[model samples]
Target: MSAEASVAAANFVTAARSFVGVPWRHLGRARTGLDCIGLVLLAAREAGVDLPDPAPYAREPQGTRLLEGILGHARRVAEAAPGDVLLFRLGLYGGHVGIASVHPAWGVPACLHAYAPRRQVVEQPMDDELRAALLGVFRLPALET
Candidate 1:
């Protein structure tokens, strides 16, 4: 990454980490509560990227066309960097989303997401199994600036 990109990534990580304890709330956006996509939305806004709200979506992945909606707002990238949106195929359809963040303990890239099962936002390593399930890595257009 270029020096500017590196700095942007650092800024994104800082902003995203501040949301660690937010409880998961479907279709919500705010520090009080957030969903996986809400986490991404917050992080991107913090990074100075304004993205349009995706159209109304469902709780399930089967027909929401989540990935397709994201593609309209961001460009898919070959590799993930801090602040990139990571889309995961948790099932047959486009399933989950998260914000990429660097893991402090391992000094490697991890993902920050609002996990519904856990009922709160958490960060976890993007291990092999997780990587294989990734549908795409997308970067906001403003990140190029």
Candidate 2:
């Protein structure tokens, strides 16, 4: 990563980690609650990147170009550092997003996401199985330093 991208990543990680325990709310974007996409938007905004608002969506929005929409504004990366956005292929669907971060307890790489099943944001260990589900890794436009 370039120096600017590194700064953006650091800034994003700082902002994203703060939302760790927020309850999951469908279509939510506030600190009180958020969904997977909401978490990404909030962190990007906090890091000084204004991403386009995702169209109103349901839990399983099908046949949408959601992946293309995000990739349009982000830089695809070969490796995910703290703060990189992770796109996951959940079975047949492919719109799940998560923020990469260091696991607070394990001190290893993990992903922070507003998991609906958990009803809250949680960090999951990024192991081989998780990597197998990864569709792509991306970083937002670099933030001003």
Candidate 3:
């Protein structure tokens, strides 16, 4: 990564970690509550990366629509680095999103996201299940060389 990209990644990771423990709220974008998209939006904003807020979306949005929205703003990447956005195929819907990060305890790749089932923001190891579901990895324009 370029020096600027490295700094942006570090800042993005830090911003994402700050959202841990925040409650989950569909289409939420505030500290009190946030959804996966909201978490990404807020973190990118805090990292000085400009990302459009594609809000007013359905809780279970179509995969194509979600992918199109992301593709319009970010570029697809072969591998996910800290601060990259991960798009996951959650069963039939496939609209989940998260910020890639390093697991603090395991020192392995993990993801920070606003999980609806867990009802809060969490950092979980990127295990096999998540890897299998991964549809794409994306890097914001600001993080590009």
Candidate 4:
């Protein structure tokens, strides 16, 4: 990463970590509750990146729609670094999104997201299953030089 990108990643990761315990809620965009995209949106704002709301989405948006939303604001990338957006396939229900980060406990690559199943925001290691599901990696334009 470039020096500017590294600084932006650090700021973004710090903002994302602040939402670790927020409860999950459909279309939520606040500290009390947030969905995956909401978590990304708010964290970007806190990191000084102003992202427009990507709303009018279902609780389980189709894969194409999710990809479209991501593409609208970010460019697909080959590798994931901290602060990059990670897209994953969630079976037939479509997809999921998260902020890439280093796991606090394991000190390995992890994802910070508002997981519906977990019913809260969490930072979990990107284990094999998650790696298998990963569809793409993306980075916000503002975070790059």
Best lDDT goes to which candidate? 3
Cα displacement (angstroms), candidate 1, residue 104, comes to: 1.2
Better of 1 and 4 by lDDT: 4
Candidate 3, residues 8-115: lDDT per residue as tens digits?
898999999999999999999999999998999899889887677777788887655755655577888899999899988866866889999999899999999999
Per-residue lDDT of 53-130 in model 2, one digit per residue for the tens? 675876786743665565576787888888888998766777789999888889999998988888998888898977
Residue-level lDDT of model 1, residues 1-145, one tens digit each, is 6778777767777777888889999887999898887777777678776666664677786744665655566788999988788888766766788888789898888998898888988888989977888888888666655
Tell me how far the alpha carbon of residue 142 in candidate 2 is from the true structure, in angstroms, after superposition. Answer: 2.0
Q: Provide the overall lDDT of each model, using Cα atoms, as 2-decimal numbers.
A: 0.79, 0.81, 0.88, 0.87
Backbone clashes in candidate 1 total 0
Candidate 4's C-alpha runs over 4 A off are: none
Report the error of model 4 at residue 74, Å: 1.8
- Lowest-scoring 10 consecutive residues by lDDT in candidate 4? 62-71
Better of 2 and 4 by lDDT: 4
Query: Which stretches of candidate 2 lie above 4 Å from their native place?
Result: 143-145
- Score every model by TM-score: 0.87, 0.87, 0.93, 0.92
Query: lDDT per residue, candidate 4, 1-145, as tens digits?
Result: 7898899988998999999999999989899899988998899899998877768687766655755655577888998999999988877743688999999888999999999999999999999988998988999897787
